[model samples]
Target: MEKIFDNTEAALALKSDSELERARFLFELIKRDTLVKIGAAVTKFALKFRLPVEGLIRSTVFDHFCGGITEDDCLPVIDRMFSKNVHAVLDYSVEGKEEEGQFDKAMFKILKTLEYARHNKAIPYIVFKPTGFGRFEIYEKLTAGKKLTQEEQVEWNRIKNRYDRVCGKAFEYDVPILIDGEESWMQDAADELAESMMFKYNKETAIVFNTLQLYRHDRLDYLKELHQQATEGRFKIGMKLVRGAYMEKERERAIRLGYQDPICKDKATTDALFNEVLIYMIKNLENMALFVGTHNEESTYLVLQIMQRCKIAENDKRIWFGQLFGMSDHISYNLANFGYNVAKYLPYGPVRDVMPFLFRRAEENTSVAGQTSRELYLIKNEMKRRKLVKSV
Candidate 1:
């Protein structure tokens, strides 16, 4: 079978020899279990005690995984990716903030991102987490059908107003906004709010996107329900489909809280569910705009196969592929090379504030079987092909 994601040269073309060498070293460290454990531990301790390790992190993983510490810092990366025909999605990745002031700040930054994106054709969309605008506990309470106190109610209203301002700006600029998925406990509120935004702004087309995590056993059904709602409500649907990021956290919480685990039974099941949703969305492309956000080779192939079967154009505006900025250049660059609409989820924030995001990337590479190994293999191949390596 011909694979769409096998173009190692195209994948690594944007990376300089030194960048590839650094990536190789990073992935090499990630592939070693003991080293990853020790590095993670040391990183945690250093951050806790205010030790000076930001420079080391900024040079290595942060540079690789994140755009930079601010929106302005992301411009060179955006231009570089756009030069390769890959678009960018600016994601403000600061997490675990709770104060109303912090929420307002996040909203301000996102609005600025949208304003910037309005002028930059290289950026297709902007994204933020719901928790970025409000407290997680409040979202959990709302999701659980619990009543909020008077002060909490006021806080909830403020969160909604923040969302409205951002989405309103997105609507004004004619740029779509993606609301990232969160843990299942808080997802219900996020989903409801996302739908409300869609209903308000998506009457003409999908301006507000809701991410669907297919690793959850119920998400396929949720997709079906949402499709029905869209049909009846007379609005276009925008969706970014992924295999889920918070699988371990969801399962651990379910176990500790004595609730059923929300994740699919295994990787195979998740893959099946993801492909099923992809097919469904493609079949209904008239009312749906889809973003395939996965690094899995088979899933990428499945999307190509389905698009071909459906006679959808390679550069259809309603369909796009997304991968994280640094992890899956093979997929992003290869797809974009073929004239497909592709974007990199470029995350940016202060280094210290974005450590949670960086640590998750490190842990994901270390824990996911073959993830780091595959990256290492591709980088080494590209290096050898360029004769950047004197000896193997």
Candidate 2:
């Protein structure tokens, strides 16, 4: 309420002049939809053919957007952010693996992060994708209410087991774990699985945080229903509320498959849905905890105002403000500077394995109205405030 986010020095305190320049250049490129699309295509082609582009990619976007290529690789970043009081959520960013071996590998990777979190206060949480632990087709089939073959059922059971293994360890370590939301078709089954984990592990506190992609119109109702069930079942609900990342995919698929589009009608509808759900969860803070993940300034301020109105301490453990590692520094760092609980989603993996995640980040920046430009503006303002850039 005191206009804290405008403090460029505090917002970019951790960034040196070189890092600020790099962020400016990257956001400038991301502002161009055509350029981002062409870059994504060319990057995919380069990675596909094993061209010698990993170093270039690593020096640029990878360093900006991700912590590192491995858990050990991320240590400096984790330590530096925690120096500013911003916590990290170690995310293994590898995507789109269908093999059982790959699933097991992802599970092991998360288990390693949980171990890291057990010893490090810098990492307050760890996260995983539901599909990362199992096959997407299995989740889709289960969500559709279709019968699974014996082998498919076995795969599904294995997926559930993977969830339990990581979640059980999280409970043991006393670290909160976040499960990311995926596209609508596959999310129902993942939601059910996350609910079961919460019911099992959240009896004392919220250890398992399921994602709510509020861009979907039905997610508010889903939250209400889940809340009712959570209350009656005597378990706490931990949720990561996001504006969603798969809007284009969701809409195109709905049109192709002749089903109602699961997305809100437009940006306004999605924004309203996100805020409405935020308020709903805030009101029920006794039984529910929140990880408010957004790049929108208005919504971030809204959360601050609500916390003040509810007399919730800025450092409340049950509530946190989260943003991506490479984006929204003003929101993440400034909030942390104000004694608020804040975490950045620190995505990391091998360069090739993480390309898909990077592509989506670029596409999301381009598609979201004003997001890229706002980032550019803030970075430029910060640079000028630091005397690294000339005033217009």
**Pick by lDDT: which candidate is best?**
2
**Residue clash pairs of candidate 2:** none
lDDT of 1 by residue, 1-392 (tens): 47866678889888988999999998898888788778878888999899999999999889998999988999999999999999999998888887889999999999999989999999999998999999999889999999999999999999899989999999999999999998999999989999999989999988999999999999989989999999999999999999888888988999999989999999889889999999899999999998888888888988898888888999998998999988888889999999999999999998888888877777776767777788888888898888954564
TM-score, candidate 1, is 0.97
Task: Evaluate residue 332 in candidate 2 and report its C-alpha lDDT on the 0 to 100 scale.
Answer: 90
Worst lDDT run of 10 residues, candidate 2, spans 383-392
Clashes of 1: 0
Query: Whose TM-score is greatest here?
Result: 2
List ranges where model 2 is wrong by over 4 Å: 388-392
lDDT of each: 0.90, 0.94
Residue 267 miss distance in model 2 (angstroms): 0.8
Which stretches in model 1 have alpha-carbon errors above 4 Å? 388-392
Candidate 2 local Cα displacement, residue 100, angstroms? 0.4
lDDT of 1 at 290: 87
Tens digits of per-residue lDDT, candidate 2, 159-266, equal: 999999999999999999999999899999999999999999999899999999999999989999999999889999999999999999999999999999999999
